[model samples]
Target: MTDFESTDRPYAAFPVRIGLQVQPQHAQYADIRRTVAAAEEIGVDVAFNWDHFYPLSGEPEGLHFECWTMLAAWAEATERIEFGALVTCNSYRNPDLLADMARTVDHISDGRLIFGIGSGWFEKDYDEYGYEFGTAGGRLDALGEALPRIERRWARLNPRPTRDIPVLIGGGGEKKTLKLVAQHANIWHGFGDAETIAHKHAVLDEHCRTIGRDPGEIERSAGVGNKSPEDIGKSMLDVGTRLFTVSSSGPDYDLGLLRDWVAWRDEVNGE
Candidate 1:
């Protein structure tokens, strides 16, 4: 077993933060906007949306909005809360172009953008959008290639990003994905129970060590799905996860869970 206690994980000093993934499916944009507003008002730390052409759950043909465009609106509409796609599919757009888009939104939000990205998965999204659905390894390789281009483009852009826009890489593929996270991500978001996430954190820490990067520099983030603060929150917190995100889908976009998590965060952070 790896000694997780050896290195000082960066998140150990970070206060607990709660994020709300206002999934853009099965709801009108107005409702989505309202949800964001409510989240900000409730003092949630970050608001996020997934980058997909269609809904991930519910009706296949349900109402869905594009990711970056809606993010632009969020940038202008809200203040104080950071926002971005939960994880933008790297295959959907060119690396340089995506960098420019992220920079523009960064400016719009006065630097509240988190550049979350991942290797493309959803086959339907690729097929419907006319992107080639290649093998998983091929896609991961592409993501590995794209990240550098994205960074280089950010460096080349005029009126560069307001701040070093935080890069949040989502996925738990230990070999490729975690390696990428160790190489680039400022925040690493993954899905799993507390025990599983703790194991991933250990794997990620080892990757960081191999590359000579501080394991603490990358924040560990997880999705809180149906689990209350009392259920998995403390367990995740004890395991070094500083960022916890709860998702709410369109139409209703109920923020009750988000509010509960926010309260939990405040309690944990002693705010």
Candidate 2:
């Protein structure tokens, strides 16, 4: 067995944070806006919108809004919850330009922006928007190239980001993706079951060691489905995962599950 199998790396001690991703599809912008406000009032730590041109579910041509613009609106609309795209597609915008947009939103939200980004998938999004739509490997390669440029651009922005602006990289590719998570990500948004997450954490640990960075420096995040939030969340938390996000799509954007998770978070955080 590898070092990941060893029990030496204790669970990273940190306050649990719960986030809600209000999917920006099949709903009027008014509904989406209202949902965000409610999520903040309910005491979620973060609010997120996915970056996509069209709806990912329900009617193909449904009421949908652009990602960054809605985020700008969210920055002004809500007070407490930090917000951003769950995972903005790097291929959609130039890296430097994306960094600038993030900085602008950061200031607007009074430093309440989390820069969550990932390599673009969803061929439909690429085809409809006239992008290249290359292989997954190609997209990952492009993302690897873009991250540094994005950071460089952040360094040069006139009004620097209100804070370092946590970089959340989403994806579970073990080889390249996990390596990038080790090198750059402040938070790593992941997927899969407790076993899957444990394995990913182990792989991430190996990469972190290779890069001479502490694995604890990058917070572990995962998406929570409706299956059994309490059971699954506890198992994940045992493995050092701290930030749990429950994603719901519109037209309703029901956050009942998210609220439960938030309560669960408080219980675990010892509040």
TM-score of each: 0.96, 0.95
The alpha-carbon lDDT assigned to residue 231 of candidate 2 equals 67
Top candidate (TM-score): 1
Please report how far candidate 2 places residue 81 from its true position, in Å.
1.2
lDDT (CA) per prediction = 0.91, 0.87
**Residues 52-73, model 2: lDDT tens digits:** 9988888998888899999999
Query: Which pairs clash (backbone N, Cα, C closer than 3 Å) in model 1?
Result: 10-216
Give per-residue lDDT, candidate 1, residue 9: 53
Model 1 TM-score is 0.96
Pairs with steric clashes in candidate 2? none
User: For model 2, what is the error of residue 139's alpha carbon versus the real structure, in angstroms, after optimal superposition?
Assistant: 0.5
